[model samples]
Target: MLTAAAHLGACAGGDPGVGSTNPFESQGNSNSMSGTTQPGSDTDSTPTVGGSMTDSDTSTPTGPGPGSDSDPTGSDPTGGPTTAGTTTLPDPDCVDDDGDLHGEGCNAGPDCDDTSFNSWQSCGTCVDQDGDGFWVGCDQYGPDEPGPDCDDANPDASDGSDCECAVTPDAKASDTCAEGMAGALGVIAEGGVVPPIKGSITGIDNGPGNGQEDWYWVEFPEAMAMGNRPNAGKIAATFAVNPGDPTSPDYRFEVYTACNKPAFEGLAATYGPGTPPAREWEFFDAHSPPNPNPNPNPNYLNNVPWPAKVFIRVIRVANDQSCSEYTLQVSRLPT
Candidate 1:
């Protein structure tokens, strides 16, 4: 029996079987590794009893192991192995040199200059110099006649759509009341000043040739220009060069009831003194005026009260051409 078992062991080493009949497999893989290789191994799996573990059949299969660079995971969708040292790169098109969070062709507007930081965006040949969404030399407020840009240098003033003076030139056509109706700045609200009424000052290049002046018509909410109403509504007017210092103002402004030859006054108390809605406040004593006052003018048509017209004349005085720009603003006082 011992002789027979030795012969069987040697015979099975040549072709190890994994079936129930093979004595090597009677025990598990670890226990049966004496002479033959484990079940389901390569054809050269068998080794000499006293020799090293090498494939006897040199024609053995060669390939990457389960997850050895050959599809790192068995379930890899691509079904291909990943390269050794791969790196991710940024998108070349999404360039933003300004570091302003907005990229070229990918923001509010196209970046005109990718090399320079904080540069303006291209608006045709022009650019939004102030980043105010309004373009310089391009987005001028015009339809009837040609007009200049709506202060593209200032970020606060976009297009002149809201201002009483639509940033239209001082005098557009020939036959106008002074410099024509520059604009109508809506009604005066209770508290703060309305949007500034902007107009270009007098210069051979800007305003009309004959005694250049810009006129704006506005209305107070209530009718009290001449103290006709019990409760009065008054307004405070302020004038400043568009790019001037309030500390040292350098513009001249006047308020009138009409755009007449000489312009009539809007006074109350049946004329003389005690005018309720201080119609013309040239001094700006920081005091007061009435809104619902009556038109103190001898000709009521010229100086009508309340909802009547309040014309503001902004003219160039001792200011440079650069300071030739002016803004007239009105605020209502709670009487």
Candidate 2:
């Protein structure tokens, strides 16, 4: 009996039971039997394994895990994974400070003269204030007939009329009187005595036998006298005949110190006789009156008193000739 008891102890220690508390224990032999007499009996002599199993699998699943669908800190359940914060952008084509639809310079808009709201996209057409069919500073694009308006501010001074002296009638040759004169005529009483008076000689016809003549009266005041005596007065004059018309008339010029208004017939001190007329003529107070010869000696200086009043006469030497036009420039020389 002791030997049999020893054998049972060895078998129990070597073989593990099917329902044992430790899973690592060895299994017992199938032939060996203990007590359990009936199946599904509450009082059966057998160990019942009832505790929970220890889980060793620690790998997270690809679908969902902590901080995933179940966790609030993970991705949103309604959507997919959470995204980073977003930012808004501005329009690329908008420009200009006035808020107008146009802009200028480097911007991507069409505003010329962006400073002025009224001039947006208006550079293609210019502004004409005077309404002479030509815009100010834009005359080069118009017809040459009326060229460019010299003064757009004044309508009277346009390209169609001679806008000289700011008057209309002063451009004609027949209008030589003071009322029609546009500029200074060297009259001493009319303020400062500015020299170099310019005038035109036109519409003057030669008489039936000789030719027609025009007279200009110049009064020099004693206070405004330029030179001292006889040598003090010097007249340098130039006459340029306008191109066209019958052969340029044989023109002559004469300066008289006396106030003689004799008929336009024979006048003394006349200088002419050259073909096509002399383009330039000069008179010196040092020489004798009535055809005063130009002073030949440069060193010689005359002290003769200059006449207070003088008459400048321009005449055509030929007869039966039509009217001729010429420009006369008279200037005073230094004494």
Please report, in order, the local distance difference test score of every candidate based on alpha carbons.
Answer: 0.38, 0.36
Stretches > 4 Å off in candidate 1: 1-175, 178-182, 189-192, 202-211, 221-228, 240-248, 261-264, 267-307
- Tens digits of per-residue lDDT for model 2, 120-238: 44444334566765443321222422334444545555653434432112332222223223233455431333444333333233332132445555655545535434434454445
- TM-score per model over all chains: 0.33, 0.29
Candidate that would win on lDDT: 1
Poorest stretch of ten by lDDT in candidate 2 = 1-10
Candidate 2 to truth, TM: 0.29
* Cα lDDT of model 1 by residue, 218-316, tens digit: 766554333333233446665533343332223444455655523324322122221111112421111122222263322122223443456665554
Tell me the deviation in Å of residue 166 in model 2.
19
